[model samples]
Target: MGVIEDLADALARDVLEAQAELGDDRFYEKMSKVLGELSPTTQEAFMTSVRVRLAEKRGRDFLARMLAAKRSGGAAPQAPRGPDSGH
Candidate 1:
């Protein structure tokens, strides 16, 4: 990821962590206050960066799933049956 995307990711993680620490009751207010403090351009850039990162992550996940399915001969994997699973 480029510098902008990297920074955006870090910022996002920080915001989420803060929200978790503050709990659901204050999450929205804290997020709104932080977002409100940002310049419009910065906010736009941050959003764009975050979107790009998400796309990349999803793309990677898709590729991994595809590879796993291919390795299993293009069939969906079956879960192992246990003694209690009724086979």
Candidate 2:
């Protein structure tokens, strides 16, 4: 991966770890507050980057699970990494 891809992967991994630690409710709460404070364009860009990074690192299935967990306010399952945390 290029430097930007590597950075995006790192960011996705961090977000996954953090969401697991915080559980869905708190994670969504924090994200909603932060996103609400951002401008619409910034929010769109941020969410797009986040989704792309997550989909790249963990696959569409994982991204779906993450979104489902967030919507349901439940804990997210651990990332399905094979080795090196799939980074």
Candidate 3:
């Protein structure tokens, strides 16, 4: 990755950790606002990193739930729907 991507990724990781530790779900928004004052490109990259990481985490959690339900002979969990999902 390029310098911007690397820096954005690192910032994303830190923001996520801080959000969890501080129980501040809006941390990403706040960080984005701060980044906006710096550079649009950097802010975009950081938001992209944050979105990808969050999506992957949600997917993993959904998978775990599905597996657990299957092991217990329960109905498989429904797939998660994102905001863009028509249903």
Candidate 4:
């Protein structure tokens, strides 16, 4: 895989591991809070990236929960990869 792919894989693995340790509810929260804070266009990119990451992590419910959280509040923490967050 290329650099971007590797980064995605690594991040996905980390998310997966974190989710396994933290459970779906918490994991979803962290992811949602983190990504949702971005600008609309960035939110789209982040969501897309997150979907790819979650696909690698096999966190299907996590993704659903994030979407739900996008409408509501689910505790998704801002990951360092985001914009305006020194990511």
Candidate 5:
């Protein structure tokens, strides 16, 4: 994916995090407010931008960069996993 798609994924993660912080009702209201701030033209442009980004090669490149950084003395943070992962 390209920058736009990466941004969207990051946004989705953020939304999920926010939902966890604020309940479903508040989350909806917050989303509505944030999205409402943008014009319809902006929304359409944003979606197209993300769609183009999603069509690119980004995830693998990003993962490789992160792993390389980790091997080159970067800290390896432990990630949280779901219960189905045999933890």
Candidate 6:
């Protein structure tokens, strides 16, 4: 990855860790604001990294749930629905 991507990825990891500890779901937004003060390019990269990491985490969680359900001979778990999902 390029310098911007590398920096953004590292910052995204830190933000995730902080959010986990503080239980503040809006931490990413706050970080975005701070990055915006630095530069629009940096802020955009950070936001993209943050979003990708978040989506990955959600997929991991869903996979774990599905695995657990399968082990217990239960029904397969449903994928999480986003606001854009009509279901």
Model 1 local distance difference test score = 0.61
Kindly list the per-residue Cα lDDT of model 5 for residues 24-69, writing each as its tens digit.
7245345534654864443444444444444343555667777987
TM-score, candidate 1, is 0.51
- lDDT-based ranking: 3, 6, 1, 2, 4, 5
Ten residues in a row with the worst lDDT in model 1? 24-33
Best-matching candidate per TM-score: 3
Model 2, position 76, has a per-residue lDDT of: 91
Question: How much is the lDDT of residue 3 in candidate 3?
Answer: 100
Measure candidate 6: CA RMSD. Answer: 2.0
Candidate 1 lDDT by residue in tens digits, 1-87: 766556656775565456657766345344544665865544555666455655676677777877899898886545446689887
Per-prediction backbone clash count: 0, 0, 0, 9, 2, 0
For model 5, which pairs clash?
Answer: 1-58, 2-53
Summarize candidate 4's per-residue lDDT along 1-87 as a digit string, tens digits.
Answer: 565555544554566567766757346446546655754443444445667765655566666667787878667644335466574
Sorting all predicted structures by TM-score, with the top scorer first, yields 3, 6, 1, 2, 5, 4
Of 2 and 6, the candidate ahead on TM-score is 6
What value of lDDT does candidate 5 attain over all alpha carbons? 0.54
Question: Ten-residue segment with the worst summed lDDT in candidate 5?
Answer: 48-57
How many angstroms is residue 56 displaced in model 4 relative to the true structure, after the best TM-score fit?
5.5
CA shift of 66, model 2, Å: 21
lDDT of 6 by residue, 1-87 (tens): 999989998999899889978989879999999989979899999999999998898899999999999999999988768799899
Candidate number that wins on TM-score, 2 or 4: 2
TM-scores vs. true structure, each candidate: 0.51, 0.39, 0.89, 0.34, 0.34, 0.86
What value of lDDT does candidate 2 attain over all alpha carbons?
0.60
lDDT of 6: 0.91
